[model samples]
Target: MIDINSWPLYVQLAFGLGPFVIGFSGGGILVFTTLRHYDRIVSSFPNSRGVQNVLRIFANYGFHPRSMQVAAIAGIVLFPRMCIRRGELEPEEVRNFPPEIKRLMVIFTTLLGVGLAWVALAVVLLKLSGGN
Candidate 1:
């Protein structure tokens, strides 16, 4: 078996921290986007009680799916630099993505986590079984 303990400190550190860094960064952005989405929803339809109620129900029921998408988007953007290059957001402007887009991000983020885990598990299993 390949000796992980023999690997350089940096390689070990990368293996240990890479997934977590991605997960934490992606998760943070997911939460941030969700909050911004909520704010937009509240501000955009403050006068509509029915719409607000409906949205509230959806939010409560749809958290997981929404979180997944946000994570995926965070992975893609990683930082605002991509957005700046694409002209999606100005340096001075706050992100106020629409609710629909926010919903999509949540779902994607959740799926991204699942996919990452699956691949990681597969690699570990293959290594353990002496498969290249």
Candidate 2:
């Protein structure tokens, strides 16, 4: 068997932590964007009891706001697109999404992007910082 220890430190770090970092960061972005989108829709339809109830249901699932946001997003991403495509949400509901939610989505996406970028940076830093 080849000796992994003989490989460069940067390579080792990248091989070791890259998958976890990328998976976590990408998932985070997807989750944050989904939650923020749903939040905006719920906020716009303040009179809609169903929307309000859905939002509350989402909130009860976790301690961190991020966790709720992520779970909402994962549902959107993983569920059948056809289900949402059917006129479940009104046009006004889509149009009335809050500006803050969009801004937060951008922020969350940026943070995840930065996190993915860091995977490489971390490998280089670890190598320079001296592991092999």
Candidate 3:
């Protein structure tokens, strides 16, 4: 792998800062746009229990204002099969979910995944390069 430390200052700044701006913009879409459709998400899977519990717990604890949003995202992303197995969402329901919502989730997930991988790669590169 190429050593990022050896790269010019501008290249290193772009490599490190580009994803930060992109990630936040994508997250803003999720918070402002995607979250507007949250009722649609709940209505699609009215049997949701686990996700509700997560929301409730966050509420009870008085977590961040967007904690429920984050939890719902986590439920959908992290424990999808568990949600299905627990009857929070049925197979048919999942299959019939709105295409736009799925697209949004896919975009959010892909961005988040790629951002994390990029950061991890940077960490490894810096470690290998014997950090400046």
- Ranking of predictions according to TM-score: 3, 1, 2
What would the per-residue lDDT of candidate 3 be over residues 2-118, giving only the tens digit for each residue?
A: 577678999999989867766775676567534467667656765566556655555643334344555375447444797787776566766767877777777766676677778
TM-scores, all models, native as reference: 0.43, 0.42, 0.74
lDDT, candidate 1, at 20: 70
lDDT of 1 by residue, 9-115 (tens): 99877766666766665566566666656445345434434334444444544667455433433443335566566654344432453546545455547655855
User: Which model, 2 or 3, shows the larger TM-score?
Assistant: 3
Error of 1 at 64 (Å): 9.1
Give the backbone clash total of model 2: 0
On TM-score, the leading prediction is: 3
lDDT of 1 at 14: 72
Name the weakest run of 10 consecutive residues (lDDT summed) in model 2: 74-83
Q: Top model by lDDT, which number?
A: 3
Candidates 1 and 3 compared: the better one by TM-score is 3
Instruction: Kindly give the stretch of ten consecutive residues in candidate 3 with the minimal lDDT sum.
Output: 60-69
lDDT (tens digit, per residue) of candidate 2 on 1-132: 345467899997776776567657666665656554654434565543444445666666443654554444333323324434664434454345565655554555555666666767656655775655
Candidate 3 segments whose C-alpha is farther than 4 A from its true place: 60-67, 70-79
